[model samples]
Target: MLILGQSPTDAPVGTFGLVNLLAFLCIVPLTVLFAPVGASLAAKLDANRLKKVFAVVLLITGVRMLAQLLL
Candidate 1:
């Protein structure tokens, strides 16, 4: 939607601003380096344990967001 000028907000569509581009460039190297390590770790982990950990993380994040919204 952002690229097609269909976003609800007023930001200009179809253009990458300098700040956005720079932030993406900075993240690219970190992602490239860490993704392979994360993949290897995940591959060695037990699937059921990973699922439980992921569920707990999601639950904690959801509760935090809900608390922030309520407060």
Candidate 2:
């Protein structure tokens, strides 16, 4: 991630960390805003197929979160 003009990994503690944390926090509203776009794409495709794809996506997300916690 870029902050001001510096890379995140090169930034000092609390600087990039807070920025990343806040960015993650914005996912809620961002998802809401993009929901329509996603729905449109899903419609253009097949709704049933998209639902299955999203189910797998959610499953992978859950597994990744679980692996993170376990690790």
Candidate 3:
């Protein structure tokens, strides 16, 4: 986003800062609500199982991003 703002465009440079601030503001409340649930889930899940799940999720997300670009 910062790089895009740096390019020749109509967008104001402060747009990056605005986006970052908005993202932070939006995430803080969600973190507060979900962190406890995540922590509890982590406690229940085996470490190896969590690692595998995280890896698969990341792979799927990467594939989805690539597909988006291709499509």
Best by lDDT: 3
How many steric clashes between backbone atoms does each model show? Answer: 0, 0, 0
Model 2: residue 54 alpha-carbon error in angstroms: 1.0
RMSD of each candidate?
A: 4.4, 8.3, 4.3
Candidate 2 Cα misplacement greater than 4 A, ranges: 1-25
Q: Tens digit of lDDT per residue, candidate 1, span 14-59?
A: 3353234456678899999999998987898899988987899999
Candidate lDDT values, in order: 0.74, 0.76, 0.77
Q: Which candidate order results from sorting by lDDT in descending order?
A: 3, 2, 1
Q: Taking the tens digit of each residue's C-alpha lDDT, what string does model 3 give over 4-52?
A: 4443355444345325555667889999999999899889999999998
Q: List, residue by residue over 1-71, the lDDT tens digit for candidate 2.
A: 34444545665445553355455568779999999998798878787888889999999999999999999
Instruction: Return the top candidate by TM-score.
Output: 3
Q: Candidate 3 regions off by >4 Å?
A: 1-21
TM-score of each prediction? 0.58, 0.50, 0.64
